[model samples]
Target: MKQRLLLATLICLPLSVLAQDSGTQSVDNEALTVYGRANVSLQSSDEGDGSYSDLESNSSRFGLKGKGQLKDQLEVFYQIEFGIDLADFDEGDDAVSNRNQVVGLRGSFGEVMLGRYDTFLKDSQGSVDAFTDYEADLKSLFRGENRPDNTVTYYSPSFNHFKVGGTFIASGDETGDDGISVGIIYGDKKLKKTPFYAALAIDRDVADYDIEQVTVATKLGATIVGAALQQFERTDGLYNSDGYLLSASHPVKQWVFKAQYQAVKYDSDKDASISVGADYFFNADTRVYAWYTGRECDIQLYQSRGCGASNGVEQDFLAVGIRHDFSW
Candidate 1:
């Protein structure tokens, strides 16, 4: 707790100093901008034994960002993002500029950034995750959704619909563990008729864990479909796991209907989940949505024993919410 507080203070101190130095002239209005998304929901969940409900602030966040040309072919950029926990008001409930805080250089060759940021393995998944920031999020059962601190990243220029990126993490504070992540993505959004996108990614934590993943998506007119597969391996060759996700969406006018299924098989356990949802777009930056997700998992109580039938559990969730995005 002390460490987090100190870090937050450090992050904010510099911005405060910059804000006060020149007052109104501190930032270039033409290059600097503020952007954010606010997502909130009323949620109900069933755990087989009982049911419960609450209001949730699903990863609502805001950020300040800017970029400017540095020379003939180079540019410099910076961003600081924070998470707001509207549903929780306790001390430390809000993250002080915790998301995608980075400074980078972009040029004709590509881009290089250093800061606390998401790994390429996490970023490459893209919108294939139909139920992100919710109870049915892909991170619940899969491993590669990481945003580690003290990292350096490089992205290659796109060529023929292909782009590549890599991330390297500095030594861990206590354990001195180092990490690396790499990913490649292809294709772009097809707005007219049929279009496709695909990505492959791998992440490695020295002597700790390794993950490989692939994601693909395609659009056909008003319908879109996507899938993802991920595999995890531990250094000790124990507790290996794998998972897959499938999703589809159809749009009719201003409304979209979506559904998804995901499954994971671990060395000693197995789990599966399904979700269905719909969204009504009020505009490009605003929408209301509702979704339901159901999950079941079975576990083995003892390593030497068979799976326990009683160790299985089921859960379900229903939620309705509005999401809004804005920039200025």
Candidate 2:
């Protein structure tokens, strides 16, 4: 408890005190900035042969971030973010501990990040995930989001609406595992009518089966849209796994409507999944969302799971939730 109190005080500390000890600007516009969101939701589900409805008691929490200019061309950044499982906050670790942490550096050439950080491809499309993240939502840019063990990522500077990023991943186990990925992004932030932007990336890794993925995104005037296509090749499996996503968002002042489509297929044996989701923003810091998905894993309905294939088994699911963000 004492430790938590100290950490909280430290985050709220004034810049004057920080400058007195460092003699440099400790906080700028987004420097020393903090951001995060909270979430609450319910679910109506069908597990192949059974159906049930449940009100989720726990949701998501918020986060805080701090950025420091280390030099004219160099900067340091850190983010302390976590989730609140309202369903069981007091049952396990404290609510504040379930967070995303990172400490990295930025410069004129590029940016290098360490600690609990997301992958290059995930970061590139994170901007589009602003509205969705759930089992049935393919628009979920980071399929599985988190700081996976030890990650070192490099982000290239943007030029001609194009940028590149790469990363090296370490196996958290003593076996000392290692893998890497490369990605390229292109887009225009300014659109004459709808105001649109887009980015595409291809990525791979040795862990969790070698994967080849491409993510694309574009935002229109009052509407934001994105799409992703990926292939997951299991080393020991007979067929590969493939999936694609399409999502769009419409804005009405502080209120926004969002939706996504997801489809996944595996192997020649057969299995597929499709999902759709929606979001309504009450404000920048708060929003409500819901999604429905259906999937089937029948091993007797396909020739292969390369690009286009479908199976006959079906499983249905639904998720509904809300989020709130607050930082100081």
Candidate 3:
């Protein structure tokens, strides 16, 4: 009698578990999102002779992104983005600028996107650089940082804090060369307390350009630090250049303090820049910033040491602006 009762109890347990699981299943809601950021700033820069000021729109954009559920392990997604210039009202037909526009499939394996978008080399840098759209942006001293049209990209699923991505560009340009870019990144952004990210990337044959870059960033409590190094080679190794950057930021309450230093060298011409800035956030979608940047460059005749010292020119940049972003 005891064995029969025990067997009956086990038979009922499976049904009870199944009922609980069915009750917890979530209802799917198919939704599309509209997102955008409107950023404008009053900026001024001095180049030894005098200071110049201008009202500018810094990467203001609008975009639509959506994903549809297909199966348990796969989905379809697409995004279309356009840049707007708030400072220019009479630009006529060139007013609307094209940004990232892509459609792709995502699955347990990874993702594949095809359209106009940024290269894997540029995406590998992520949010490492504190100053992106400002005067001291990394692109000011680096090469091959771009978003191109007619591109295909792939990203691998992360495993053990490691992931890889690649991009191919089929742009019909004067160089008559196809572009290839690839990168590998480590560490997950969800980590807390001591999260770290590192990446290495290479780009070739994009408008007769070839470049290799390495970037790393880490967060320790409230402090973030990042660094990057790049080598540029072109014309079958006949020309070569290199650049490096170092940056750090600390956040306190609603404010963030940031600083960066960068240097680039090509032949005998060398340029170096340093910038310091602060930002105040009103909320998650709005903020104000002030920054100061200074640069010095020298042109040499024979790639000799200490050349063009007297011919060097110094420049300075200062800006204060507000940025707002919205999404639905």
Candidate 4:
């Protein structure tokens, strides 16, 4: 009787363990994820007036991103991030971090995000950059979307050949302007070519001013290019506008030869300007770049208080720099 009781106990134990695991399977596989990145480099800048040199810390940073499945039809997700700038050299404390937070949800319709995050155009700019980070050849010059504070965003699933996204900025709690931006990116899988992109953005203040930006970008092999034309208007009759950039790259083993040209036309009769540059890449994440930029600005006669059309002058700039990317 004792041996039979022990055998039955062992059999029941296995059945009990199976029942517990079956009930907890869903809990063990709960939806969640984590990811991050980091980077650093050396750079130099020459604006024709002077040359500045320093080792710049790229977006050496990290963060947590994940989602939780509440049911078959509903789920929630979020991301919080920050940068680490090693350029300071002093590692003790004086570090600064900026606009790197994101939160959102996915549903049957689409995904809606709210937090301090990059606007859509931000990623588009990086697509064409030799170095798509702080150490990048033209990062400051590009001024892509990057991250913004108190922003709301939405991303939609692809419809045939297009994937679309939009973002709204302006918590009104800060000095920033209220803006809405939208973009459409088209993929051509059949052609085996890079996708094409187009975007329109508008920003305004209820009683003060307004502005608009329209952009287009595309890439072919080692060449990536983009353009953004923007118009700014204010109640005081102040109008301003400008746009330009052309680029190409050829990769040979570990090195790349790149060329770029840019032009700018100003509303103030600043005469059109043109720029050209070249770079050699050591790798996909790093490169050394140099540029020659020239600009012609109009002069105003002190006596006539009007434009002196012929007084246009030109300034030349020679620039050299290195770029790198980081992810942690």
> Which lDDT value does model 4 have at 302?
15
Better of 3 and 4 by TM-score: 3
The sequence of per-residue lDDT tens digits that candidate 3 reaches over residues 42-139 is: 98977666888988788899999998765565667899999998876673556689999998767665777778989889988977778988888888
Candidate 1 residue pairs that clash: none
**Candidate 4 lDDT tens digits, 1-328:** 3323422432343344344334332412344444444444444544334566666565666566677764454456787776766566575764657546876656554566777877665543433444344322343222233466757776666676566666666546556445554556565422245466555554443123354556556667655555555454553555444445554556566555555444333544443334555667676666666655454445232101111233454444445655564343
| Candidate 1 vs candidate 4, lDDT winner | 1
Segments in model 4 whose C-alpha atoms lie over 4 Å from true places: 1-38, 47-52, 89-94, 123-126, 130-146, 173-178, 188-195, 205-211, 219-222, 234-237, 268-328
**TM-scores of the candidates in the order shown:** 0.84, 0.72, 0.84, 0.63
- The superposed Cα distance between candidate 3 and the true structure at residue 45, in angstroms, equals 1.8
Local accuracy of candidate 1 as per-residue lDDT tens digits, 255-290: 999999988786657777899999999999999999
Model 3 steric clash pairs: none
* Residue 174, candidate 3: C-alpha displacement in angstroms: 9.1
Ranking by TM-score: 1, 3, 2, 4
- Between which residue pairs do clashes occur in model 4? 36-328, 37-327, 37-328, 38-326, 38-327, 38-328, 39-326, 122-145, 135-323
> lDDT (0-100) at residue 74 of candidate 3?
61
Mark the 10 consecutive residues where model 3 has the least summed lDDT. 301-310
Best by lDDT: 3
User: Model 2, stretches more than 4 Å misplaced?
Assistant: 1-34, 57-59, 89-99, 127-131, 139-146, 172-176, 188-202, 219-221, 235-239, 252-255, 267-278, 299-313
Q: Please, what are the lDDT tens digits per residue for candidate 2 over residues 1-328?
A: 3323422332333222334345545544354655655556677766555778765544365677877766466667877767655654555566555445677666665666666666665555544543344554332222323346566666767887677776667666666445555567776433332344555554444444455666555656567777667776544465466766676767776655666655555444434455556567776667777777666555453332211233344567677777677766
